[model samples]
Target chain A: MTFFEIMLLLFLIACAISIFFIKRLVNAVVVFMSYSAIMAVLWLSLESPDLAITEAAVGCGITTLLFILALKKVNALKEDGEADRDEHNI
Target chain B: MSIISEEGKKTLTSFSDWVSANSPDIPAEVVYPPKKDDHGHGHDDHGHDDHGDAHCDAHEEAHEEAHEELRSSAYEALHASDAPPAAPAAVTAQPKEKETVTEEGPMTERTFVRTLGAGYRLIAAVCGVLLAIILLVTVAFLPRFGSAENPALNEVSRRYLEEGLTDTGAVNTVAGMILDYRAFDTLGESIVLFTATVTVIFLLQQSRRKNDEARALEEEDLQQGVRSLPARVVIGIAFPFAMLYGIYVVLNGHLSPGGGFSGGTILGGTLILAHLAFGEQYTQRFATITRCTGILSVALLVYMGLKSYSVLTGANGMESMVPLGTPGSIFSAGLIFPLNICVGLVVACTMFTLYSLFTKWKA
Candidate 1:
C-alpha cells in the first residue's frame, strides 16, 4: 500500500476505536462522520469514483445529519442535557 | 475463556458506571445509596471497587434527604411489626446490600439480563475471531493481488471490456454493464428503494390533526428557520450549482464514472439543504408527500416496463427494436440513458422523503 493509503487506513482504525471510548454521543457521531469521509477518499483512491461520491453524500452527509437529528429528538444533545440537569438541580 | 470473561466483566462494569453517571433521569441516590457499617461495606467493596471513597461520601451528602425518606418508611414498617426502632436501621442496610449482590451475581431478572448480555458478548467475540482466521486462511491460499493469473481476470470480464461498448453502445463500460447488461438487477434495486420509502412512511407518518403543543413547537422551529440569515444566504448561493452538478452527473452516466446512485444522492442532499435554508413551507410547496410518492411510483414502474420489454425481446431471439445509437454520446445508449434517469429519480425521491419524514413527522 502507498503511504497515503496506509495513513488513511490507520486513521480509520483509530476513529473506530475512539468511537467506543468517547464519552459523549455527539462526539462519537462526529468521529464516525470522519471515518466515513476517510472511507470515501479510500474508495476514490481504489479507482471507484461512483462509490466515493455515494459514500461522501450518503455516508457522511445524510447519515450524520440523521444521527444529529435523532440525538436532538432524544434530548441527548450536550446543551439540552445540561439545561435539563440545571432544572433538576433547581 | 476465563481471561476473555474477565475482560468482558470489566467492560460491562465500566459501561454501566458510565451510564449511571451520565444519564440525568436516574437519581444518584437510587444508583448509589448511603452504605451502612456492616454488610454494605463488603458489597460496596465488591461492586464499587474502582469508585473512590470520596465519590461515595459526596453521594451520601447529596442524597441526605432521600436517606431520611427511606429511613422513615423503614421505621414505620418496623413499628407496625412491634420491632425496636433500631431494627429499622438494620432492615434499611439490607436493601442496598441485597441490590448490590443481585447486580454482581445471577439472582434475579436483572441478573438474567446481565448474564445474557455477557454471553452475547462472548459469542460475538468468538465468532469474530473465527471469521477473521477463516478469511485470513482463504486469502493466504488465493493468488497474489493484482496478478494477471488471478481468476478474477477471466473471460467474463474480458468479454465485457472488449464488447461492452459495441453491445450496449455506451462508452462507459460500468454503466453499460449495470444499466444495459444487468438492467434487471438495477430494477430490483429501484424497487428496494421504493419499498424502503413506503415502509418508513407507513411507520412514521403522523396523524392529520396535530396537538396544540406539537403545533407550537413547529411554529417555533419555523421562526428559528427564518432567523438564520447566514444559512439562508449560503444555501441560496450553493443550491442551484449543486443541483446542476447532480443533473450533469446523472445525464453523463453513459460517458463517465458516476451514474444514478451518486448523482441521486447529491440531488437529495441539495433538496435537504434547501429545506433547511428555506423552511418547510417553501420546500413542501413543491415536494409534498403525495408528489414524492407519485414520483417514486412512476420512476419504478417506468424502470420495470423498460427492463421487462428488453428481457422479453432478448429471450424470444427476435431483433429488438430499440436502436443502439452512436457511442460517446448522451442519447447513444439504447436503454441505459432512460434507465439511469429512472433510477436517479427513484433514489432522489426516496432520500428526500426519508429526510422529510424523519424531521417533520412524529413516529
Candidate 2:
C-alpha cells in the first residue's frame, strides 16, 4: 500500500515537471489533469479522503475542463494559425 | 500603521528631495485630448462618427468596447464627478490607459526589441539569489513539518477531532471544523469566488457582447460544430450520471469525506460537459450568465445571512434553535446541511461563470 503511495507521488512529480516543459498548451493541460488525479491518490493514501475527493473533482475534473474550454476558445494546437497566435501569446 | 513624528515626516521630505535630485529628469507630460463627455461616452461618439460600413463599424465598436470595458469603473466614476475640469490630469494619471490601441502599435519596433545588454540579467540574477537566501532563512526558522509540538497541532484542532461529531452531528471532522467552528473562513472563500466571477464578468462583458454578435450570425445555421453523433450519445449517458454523483456527494457530506466544495466541483464539471457536448448555443439556452449570477449572488447572500445569525447567537450566549437531529444520519447536522447546499450553489455558479467569461460567453 505504501509502495503504491510512493509510486503515485513520484508519478505526480513527473507529471508536474512534464507539464511545465511540454511547450504545447493542450498537451500541458492533459498532463496537468493526470497530475491532479495522481495528487488525489496521494491524498487518499495520506488518510485525507476529503482532500482526495476535492483534488479529483475540482483539480482533475473541473480545472481540466476549464483548460479544454479555453483551448477551444483559442483554437489551440490546430497549428494552421498557430504562427499568428504565437506572436500574440503572452 | 506606524505614527510618523514631525522629525520622521521631515526626514521623509528630505528623502523625497534626495530621490528627486538623484533620479533622472522627469519627462514632460504628453497630454491626451480632454475627454469630451463625463460618462466616457466620448469614445462611443467617436466610433459612431466614422460612418463606416456596418460590419466594420460593428467590429470597431466591439473592439473599442472591449478595451474600454477593461478599464476600471472607479477611474471613470472619478472622471464623471470632476465636472470635466480635471479630465487632463486624470488622463495623465492613467498614462498607459490613454495610449492608442491601434493597428501599428503603441511602441516602435526598436523600443520593443531593445535590451539592457548583459548588466540587467546579472542584476536580476543577484537579486533573485538574495531573495532566495532570505526566503530560505525564513523557512529554516519555521517549525518542522508534522512535528508533535508544532503550533498547527494546537488544542483547538485536537478538541475538534475528538468532539466535532458529537457536538456538530457531522461525522466528517473536516466538515465540522470548516462549516461550524471556523465557518467564517469558508464564508470568506465563497465571497472570494463570488468577487472573482463578478470581476471576470465585468471585465469581459463587452467581449461577451461581441461574441454574441458573431453567434447571432452563426445561430441561423443548424447545430453542427460540437455535437457529433457519437459524442452526443456518450455525453447523454455521462452527464446525468455525473450530476447524480455530485448531488449524492453534497447530501452525504456530513457522513463522508466529500462536502460542498468537492461536490460542487463535480456539479461544475457536469455543466462543463453540457457546454462541450451540447455546443455553446445549446448550453446557453439554460446556463446564461445572468441566471448563474442571480443564483450565485442569492446563494452567497444566504450563506452570509446564516453565518451572521450564527455569529450573533454565539455572541449573545444563546443556544441555536436548529436541531442536531442524529449523529451518523443524513438529516443529522442542522445548519451544516443548508450551508453545504448554499456553498454548492455558489461553487457551481462560479465554475460556470468562469467558463462563460473565458469563452467570451458566446452562447
Candidate 3:
C-alpha cells in the first residue's frame, strides 16, 4: 500500500510483538513508551494533533509516573519476601 | 542471540553445549511433533493423550503465571530502587497506618454509614461503567448512523456557526463559541484548574511548613535542593519562550483559533519546564505567581460574567466597543479576545500550581 500505511502497519506489528513477548515490567514500560510514540505518530497521520499531544503527554508522561509508582509498590512487596516466595509456590 | 556479537556468540555456544549434553542423540524432526493429529483414528487411543494434553496446557499456564509474577516482582524491585526516598516512606506508611475513621461512634451508626458508603460507591461504579459502554457502543455503531463522514462534526459546526458567530464576531465560529458565547463555561474550566492548584498548594504547604519548622528546631537541612546543570540551562532558555508564547496566545485570542486554554497551557508548560530543569526548589519561588493568578482569574471571571450578561438565560446583551471590522480580520472578534485571555491566564496558573504541589514533598 502507501508508505505511510506501511509504516503504521510496521509500528502496530512492533507494538503487538512487544506486548506479546516483553516480560520484564520495566522493559514492558519502555515498550509501552515506544508504543505511545508510535500511536502519536499514527494520530498525526490521521490529522489529530490535539489528540496526539494528549496521548503523548498523558499516556507517556503521567501514565508512566503512575506505572513507576505502581512498580515501586510491587517492589516493596518483593522486598517484603511475599511476591518472590509466592512465585515459587505458583 | 547470534554468533555475530561477542555476548551472543558466547550465549549460543553455551546453549548449544547444554542442549547437546541434555539430548545428544535427539534429531530436530523428532523433537518437533507433527503439525496435524496423527493419532485421531479412535477415541480410545487419543482419550488418555487428550487428557494429558489438557493437563499440560494447564501446567504451562501456571508456569507462565509464575514467570509473570517473578517479572512483576523484579520490575517492582527496579522501580523501588530508582524512586526518591519520600515515595517509599509514604507507601510503607500507608499499609502500616490504621485508618481510624469512625461513623459517629455507635455500632448501628457505623454499620449504616458503611452500608451507605458502599451503596454510593456501587452506584457511581455502575454509572461509570454504563457511560463507558454507551460511548463505546456509539463509537462502534457510528458508521451505521451516517455514510462518508461523521454527522456529529458537521452538526456541531453548523450549531456553532448559526447561534454563536454574530455574538463573538470571529470568522472561526467554533473558536468564538468556545471563548465568548460560552465564556462562563470557559471561566468555570479555568476556575476548576485554579481550584486544583490551590488544593495542591494547600495540601503540600502545611506538611512542608511543619517539616521546615521541625528541621529548624533540630538545626538541620533535611531536604537537599535540586541540581541539574543541563535542566537549568534548558529551563532558562525555554521558560522565556514559553511565557512569551503564552502571552501571545492570550493576547491574540480573537485574531486566531487559539485562546485562553491554549495560552494557559504554554504558561503551565513553562512551570513544568522550570521544575524539570532546576528541580523542586524553583517551584517555591513561583508560588506568588500561582497565588496571584489564581485570585485574579476568579475575580476577572466574576466581573466579566456580570458585565457581559444582563439576564444570563434567554438573551445575552453584552456590548463591545471594538467593531466587527471584517470577516477574517484579527480585530473583528468582539468579546472573544478578552474572554479567551482570561481563560488562558487562569488555566496556566492553576496547572503550574498543581504540578508544583505534586513534585514537592514534606522533608
Candidate 4:
C-alpha cells in the first residue's frame, strides 16, 4: 500500500478499535461515524468512487443519525460525573 | 386553474368523490370537518404555517375529523367508567398527545440482565485467539490481491474489459457492465432492498404514529442549545447543491464512476439531513410513509417490467429497436438511462422507508 493509504488504514483500524473500547455509548457512536468516514476515504484510495460515495452517505450519514436517534430513544446518557474525567485522552 | 374559486371547486369535488368512494359509510360532510382557521388539523396545536394548497387543506381536515372522533370517544369512555365525574376532569388534564418521553432516568449497570465472570472472559479470549489463528491459516491459501492470473478475474473480467464499450456504448465500463451486462444481479439486489422495506413495514405495522420520544429529544436538544443557527444555515445552503449533485451522478452514470445505487443513497442522505435539520414534521410532510411506498412500488414495477421485456426480447433473438446514441453522451445507453432512474427512485424510497420505520417502530 502507498504511504497515505497505509496511514488511512491505520487510522481506520484505530478508530474501529477505539469504538469497541469506549465506555460511553455516545462517544463510541461518534467514533464509529469517524471510522465510517475514514473507511469511505479508504474506498476512494482504492479507486472506487462509487463505493466511497455509498459508504460516506449510508454508513456515516444515515447510519450515524440512526444510531444517535436509537440512543436517544433508549436514553443512552452517561450519568453525571460517572464517566472518565481524564481530559488528556479522547 | 385560472381563479382560486374555480380551482378550489375542481379539487374539492374530486376530493369529495374520493372520500365517498373510499369510505361509503362515512358521509363526505362528516369526513371533511368544519372549515376552521388556517391551521386545519385539531392535533396541529403547534403553529404550523399552512401552505395554502387545497390538497393539504383537505388532508388536514381529514386528520382533524379523526382527531375529534378520537377525543369524543375518549370522553365517552371516561364518562362510562365507574370513577367519579371529577376523574374525567383529571383525564382531560393529561393529554396523551404530549406524553412523549417517559419518566425514566438513564440506564445503569444494574439494569443489565447478567454480567460475565472473569472465567468466562478468559475462555472467550482463548476461543477468539483460536478462531483468529484458523482464519489466518485459511487466508494463506487464498490468491494474492491484484494478481494477473487470479482465477476469479480470468474469463469474466477479460470479456467485460474487451467488449464492454462496443456492446454497451458507455465510457464507464463498470457502469456499462453493471447496468447492462450483469443487470440481473442488480435487479436481485434492488428487489432485496424492496423486500426488506416491505418486511420492516409488515413487522412494525401498528406502531404509534408519532415518533414521539425522538421528537422529544430534539425539542430538548433545541432547548439546550445543541442545535445551532449557523449549522442550520449551512445545511440550508448545502441542500440544493447536494440534491443537484445526486441527480447529476445518477444521470451521468454511464459516463462516470457512480451509478443508481450510490446516487440514490446520496439523495437519501439529503432526506436524512432534512430530518436532522428541519425535524421530523418537515421530513414527514415531504417523505411520508404512504408517499414513499407509492414511489417504491412504481419504481420497482418499472424496473421489473422493463428488464423482463429486455430479457424476453433478447431470448427471442429480437434486438431492441431504439438505437444506442453516441457513446460518452448523456443519452448513449438505451435502457440504462430509464433503468437507472427506476433504480435510483426505488433505492431512495427504500432508504427513507427503512429509516422512518426503524425510528418509529414501537415493537
Candidate 5:
C-alpha cells in the first residue's frame, strides 16, 4: 500500500479504538464522524465513486447528526456551566 | 465444582477473597446487628427460663440506653456544626439503618445474585474473545485483495459489465446494474427506508403527545435559529444551489456516478440545513409530516408497480414494451430514471422525518 493509504487505515483503527476509551460521549461521536469521513476517502481511492458518495453523505453526514441528536435527547450534551454545577452538587 | 482442579479451586477462592476485600466497606456491626441477640436466644433454649429472662431484660435496657445516647449526640452535632460533616454522617447512618433490616432478611438471596452477576460477566468475556478469534482466523484465510484468482471476479460481474449498457441503455453501468438489472433489491432498500420512517413516527408520536410545555420550549428555541445575521444570509444565498445540485445528481443517475441514495441524502441534508437556518415554522409550511408521508408512500407504490411490471414481463418470456432511448440522453433508460426519482424521494423523506422526530423527542 502507498503511504497515504497506510496512514488512512491507521487513523481509522486509532479512531475506532479511541472511541471506546474516550470518556465524553460527544468526543466519541466526533471521532466516529472522522472515521466515517476517512472511510469515504478510502472508498474513493478504491475507484468506487458511487460508494464514496453514499458513504460521505450517509455515514459522515446523516449518521453523525443522528448520533448528536440522540446524545442531546439523552441530556449527554450538557453546557460546561451546568456540568460544573452538577459536579459541585455531587 | 468437580470441573475445577485443586489449583483452580484455590485460585477461585483467593480471587473471591480479593474481590470481597476490594469491594466497598460496609461496617460489620451494621450487617450483623442481631447476631448477639440470636446467641442469647440459643443459650436460653438450652438453659433455665429465669436466667434467660434476666439476660434478655439486661440486653433490652442496654439497647435502649445506646439508642438514647445516639439520638442526643446527633442532635448536639446538628446544632453545633456547619452542616457539611452532619450531612455525610446522616447519609452514612440512613443507609446503614435500611441495610440492617433488608440485608438480614435476604442474606442468602443477595449472595446468590452476586455469584450470578460474576458468572454472567465471565461468560460474556469468554464468548466475546472466542468470537473475535474466530473472525480473525476467518480473515486470515480469505483471498488476497485485487488478485486475479479471487472468487468474486466471476461470471456474474462479467455479464453485468459486458452487456450492461446495450441491455439497460444507460452509460453508468453501476446505475444500470442496480436500478435496472437488480431492480428488486433497490425496491427492498427503498421499502426499508419507508418502514423506518413510519416506525420512528409511530414511536415518537406517543411521547410527543404528553410534552406540550417542552414542545413549546423547543418551538421557541427553533425560532432563534442561526443567531448571527451573516450566517443566516450565507445559508439563504447558498440553499437553492445546494438543492439544485442534489436534484441534478438524482436526475442524472443513468448518465453519471451519482444515484438515488447519495443524491437523496444530500437533498435531505439540504432540507435539514434550511430548517436550521429559517426555523421549523418556515420549513413546516412546505414539508409537513402528513404531506411528506403522502409523497413517500406514493413514490414507493409507483416504484413497486413499475418493478412488478418489468418482473412479470421478463418471467413470461415477453419483450418489454418500454423503449430504451438513446444511451447518453437525459430521457433514456426508461424505467431507471423514474425508479431513481422514486428511491430518491423515499430516502429524502425518511432522512427528514428521522431528523425532525429526533429533535421533537429531544424536547
Candidate 6:
C-alpha cells in the first residue's frame, strides 16, 4: 500500500482497538475525535476539500462542543462522579 | 483437577477412530487434534466406548440422585394434581442435544425461508412505489423540458430609465420603477409582511394561556432554571448590532444589494436572537407593541396602495402620485423610498411573528 494508505489503515486499526479495549466514555470520546480528524484528512486526500472542511468543522468542532456540554450537564444533574467517569472511559 | 477427564479421552479416541474408519481419505490430524493423554484400549474402542459410558461416572451418580429426587417430586405432584400426561420420560429427556439439533434444524430453515420471502416482497413493493413516482414526475415535466417559468409583468421602466430619468432624476431604475411607477405592489408586499407578523404574534400569545393553565395546575413542572450566562451574554451583545445592520441593509437596499425584504428579515433575525438570549417571559412583555406594529404596518401599506393606485388590485399602469426627485438622491425614487420602508416593516414584523410562534410553542 501507499504511505498515506498505510497511515490511514493504521489510524483505522487504532480506532477499532480503542473502541474494543477502551473502557472510559470520555477517553472513547477523545479517540472518536481522533478518528474524525483522520477521516477529514482522508477526505482531503481524496480531493473533496469542501466536504473535508465541513466534516472537520461539524464533526470535530460543533459535535464535540455539544458532547462536552451534554457531559457537563449530565454530570451536574447527578452527584456521583467516579462511577460515570470510569464508565465513560470505557 | 484433570484438564481432560478419562471419559473425555475415551470419547476423543472413539471420535478419531470413527473419522478414520468412515473416511480414510481424510487426514487423521484434520479430524482431531493429537491426543495429549493415552487411553488403555488400543482397538475396538470406538464401538466399545458408547455415548453413555463417555460421560463421567461421578456425573452419572449425581444424575441418578437428582433423578430420584425429581421422581419423588413428580409422584407428589401427580397425587396432588388432577391431570397427568402419558409419556413422563418423553417430557423429561426432551432436551437431548442430538434430538434437539435434528428436530430444530429443519424448523429454523422453514422460518428463515418464510422471513426472507416476506422481505423480498416488501422490497418489491417499495421499489414499485418509487418507480411509479419517478415515472409520473418525469412524464409530467417532459413536455416543458423542466423549465417552469413565471409570466412576466409589463416592462415599463426600460424607457423610463433612458428618457424619463433625465427629468424624473431617479438613477436606480428599480427604485424609480418600484416607488414612482409601481409603489402599490411594494406597499402590498409590505402589508403582507405585516399581516404575517400579526398572525405570528397571535399564535405566540397562546403561550400565555398555557402559562396560566400551568399556574392553575402544576407550576412546579415549569423549567424555571437559568440558561448559560455565556450564551445569554453573547446573544445579548450581538443583538443590537445585528438589528442595526439589518436596518442599514433595508434602507440602503436601493443603493446596494439588499432591499426592504432583506432588511426586514435581518431585523426579524435580530429580534429572534434576542428572544433566544432572553426567556419567553421577555417576549410576552413586548407582545402588545409587536402586535400593534404588525397590524399598523399592514394598514399603512394598504392605505398607500389604495390611495395611490385608486384602481382595482393586480391592474397595471397605476399613476405615480408623487413626482420623481433628482437622480441618485434618496428622494429621487418617488414612491420607492416609501415602498422600501413598507417592505422593511413587513419583513421585520413577519419574522418577529414567526419567532414569537416558535418561542410560544416551545414554552
Between candidates 3 and 4, which one is better according to TM-score? 4
lDDT of 5 by residue, A2-89 (tens): 8999999999999987986676678888899999999999998898999998998888888887887787655456443234323322
> Compared with the true structure, what per-residue lDDT tens digits does model 3 show for residues B42-126?
2222222232232222222222323322323332332232223223221233232221221122345546767887788789789
lDDT of model 2, residue B248: 90
User: Candidate 1 lDDT, tens digit per residue, B224-299?
Assistant: 3444568899999999999999998888999998889888888888888887778787788788767988999998
My TM-score estimates for the predictions, one after another, are 0.70, 0.67, 0.53, 0.68, 0.71, 0.41
Rank order by DockQ, top first? 2, 5, 1, 4, 3, 6
Q: Which regions in candidate 5 have their CA more than 4 angstroms from the true location? A: A79-90, B1-130, B226-234
Residue lDDT tens for model 2, B155-261: 88899989887778898888888899989999999999999998988878865454333344334322333435688788879998999999998888888988899
The reply for model 2, stretches above 4 Å from the true place, is A84-90, B1-147, B211-213, B218-225, B280-286, B360-363
TM-score computed on alpha carbons, candidate 5? 0.71
Per-model C-alpha RMSD? 12.3, 17.1, 18.7, 13.8, 18.0, 23.3
Off by over 4 Å in 3: A1-90, B1-140, B144-150, B153-156, B161-167, B213-226, B279-322
Report the lDDT tens digits of candidate 4 across residue range B219-301. 43222322446877887799889988889878888888888988898888787676667666667767888899999999889
Q: What order do candidates take by TM-score, descending?
A: 5, 1, 4, 2, 3, 6
Steric clashes per prediction: 0, 0, 2, 0, 0, 14
B1-363: candidate 6 lDDT, tens digit per residue:
353464354344334433333334434344444333212221122232232422222222223323422323322232111112222222234356633553455456657767887788789789978998999988786545223342222244346657656533455455555554566676666656656756766766665464342232212211221255788788778877877887776676555445665566666656655655675556556543567475556647554764455344225665556665665666655555666666667656665665445433423
| Candidate with more favorable, higher DockQ: 4 or 5 | 5
- Candidate 6, overall lDDT? 0.51
* lDDT (C-alpha, whole model) for all candidates: 0.70, 0.67, 0.52, 0.67, 0.70, 0.51
The C-alpha stretches of model 1 lying farther than 4 A from their native spots are: A79-90, B1-142, B206-213, B222-229
B-chain TM-scores per prediction:
0.66, 0.62, 0.52, 0.63, 0.65, 0.47
| Residue A76 accuracy (lDDT) in model 4 | 43
Give the docking tier of candidate 2. acceptable
